[model samples]
Target: MLRRLALATLATTAAGLGPLPPLPLLAPAGPDTLTVTIAESGHPDADGTFELSCGDKAGGNHPARDKACERLERLAGAAEDPFRPVPEGQPCTQVYGGPAVAQVTGTWRGRSVDARFSRADGCEIARWENLEPVLPLVRG
Candidate 1:
């Protein structure tokens, strides 16, 4: 019986009589969108509000949309919020990063996120750099 079944299957394929039924596709990722605002008094050109949408597709006016989206996707698994503020009383270096300030507001991975970033202190600077192109790179 096994030999007969195998032969039958082989004959069906050789006769070009197989086209598997299509499987249903899954839904795309939910809308992950954000509005990023950066302010730099010294560099007026870099100060502006930019839109960023990331999910199955990356869209919006952000200059580095693809890279930003990739970075966001990579960070999705972390337990910590990328935009979260530094913990109160956390030790941070006294070195000044700069005057650049940024705010990111959006819904990411089904959670609402509103994170502020700055280069005021070491902790703040690390938070800002954590997002990379999602937040503009600044030099102090």
Candidate 2:
């Protein structure tokens, strides 16, 4: 009787071990997101400069031309220098005054993505549409 009880207890313990609850599969990393960095130039009256690193289809937009231009002008004024003129031989005309709006098209991971920017301090301030994907995490 004792041997049987010991055997039964062992069996119960073994049964309790059952296969480790399906190891909750680890989630895979999703697509990358947009990243922006702003730095203040030491020079007085220098508008802060920003660098934007775009990722995947996560960034794109179609902001109104006038609005974009306005933003660009503000950025330039803050940066203490107007937009740099396009190189002498460049196909695109030099942008000056107000905002600089141009369709921003790019390729990432073999996919085509588009975005718009208002040139500020020689950098692009991403519009709402382009910034939407990254807003949630950044907000809090």
Candidate 3:
């Protein structure tokens, strides 16, 4: 019986019949999508729009989709809120970093996201800068 089974297996291999099915015939699932927009307060020419998809595959119109997704992953790991409020009573520099404002609206890991960013104050500036990996300055 053992010899017969071995012969059958050899015969199947020789006939190009394998246990696994072909992978190409199966269609892959789609990725999740995120929309990001940056608008300069007084400089419309510097505004930009980007789209990013993360899941089974990385895609979308974002120039750095992979890097953006990675940054979002790190943010999730730390349970950090991208829209955290500025610390009360914390004195900030009275300087203007820029007039750039950004908004990120999408779903991440099944959670809805609507984060807004600006470089108006010190804390907000930090928040905006922290997300630089995903949202870079795009001068139109």
lDDT value, residue 49 of candidate 3 = 86
TM-score (C-alpha, index-matched) for candidate 2: 0.18
Clashes of each: 0, 2, 0
lDDT of 1 by residue, 26-117 (tens): 43468789999999825666689999999778999998989999998888766556877888999999979989998899888777778888
How much lDDT does candidate 1 score? 0.84
**Model 2 lDDT per residue over 57-96, tens place:** 2222322223433443354347522223333554532432
lDDT of 3 by residue, 1-140 (tens): 76876777778888889533323442234455688898774555436888889875678988778887788768867977665557789888765667788888887656567888888877777877777656775322
lDDT of 2 at 101: 35
User: Which residue pairs in model 1 clash with each other?
Assistant: none
Ranking by lDDT: 1, 3, 2
Indicate whether candidate 1 or candidate 2 has the larger TM-score. Answer: 1
